[model samples]
Target: MAGDVRAASMTARAFVEDYLLWTRGQRAPSRIAGASGDVRRELVALRLRPSRGTRRGRPQITELRTDLTSPTAGRATARVIDRVLGAQYTLRLDLARGTDGWEVTDVSA
Candidate 1:
């Protein structure tokens, strides 16, 4: 049970990291799940498409903390520092377990 919680936490953390990277144009959008339409549109609107010789390095996940309230629901917070942009950002995530696994139900920064 403890291990399951840990795995869910890790999964949520990785999901947030990958989603952020996608928003910043450093990652592709193939593997992510449970993203809202508005979020995707916003990312697309940013026009931050990655290109060769881009100025910013990939963003790094600094600190990720997860709270598993139950087997079905949890929350997480993460700190990401963008080396290229020279900025630090926080991500707050809400997760819910499903038949497939953990899914991000909501996220904010």
Candidate 2:
């Protein structure tokens, strides 16, 4: 017997978490499905951060929120709560539902 037939999908926040993991090199690119070409390329271009004198490590997501505008559209914002490079920056994302699942359509600082 087979399991549930429904296609498993991730929430907007979960997708963002995966994206952040990819950015930190904690997860592989293949782990993130339904991302746009540009998003994929950007992730590929990211390099690991070099350790500074501080004992602290990589940046971590402090807080995040997602607004599901519709069944097909979602907007999300993530903030780095930990101390690290670009920690002050906030990631804003626009997502849309594709044939496969929800994929990021746009990203802004």
Best prediction by TM-score: 1
After superposition on all CA atoms, what RMSD does each candidate show versus the true structure?
3.3, 6.1
Off by over 4 Å in 1: 33-55
Distance from true location, Cα of 17 in model 2, Å: 2.4
Candidate 1 per-residue C-alpha lDDT over 2-108 given as tens digits, one digit per residue, 9 for 90 to 100: 87678777777778867866765667555455544445555556667666534356777889888888878888898988866678999998877778777777778
* lDDT score, candidate 2, position 84: 58
CA lDDT scores, all candidates in order: 0.73, 0.61
**TM-score of structure candidate 1:** 0.73
Report the poorest 10 consecutive residues by lDDT, candidate 1.
Answer: 31-40
Candidate 2 residue pairs in clash (backbone atoms < 3 Å): none
Q: What is the alpha-carbon lDDT for the whole of candidate 1?
A: 0.73
Q: Count the backbone clashes (under 3 Å) in each candidate.
A: 0, 0
Per-residue error for 19 in candidate 2, Å, reads: 2.9
TM-score of each model, in listed order: 0.73, 0.60
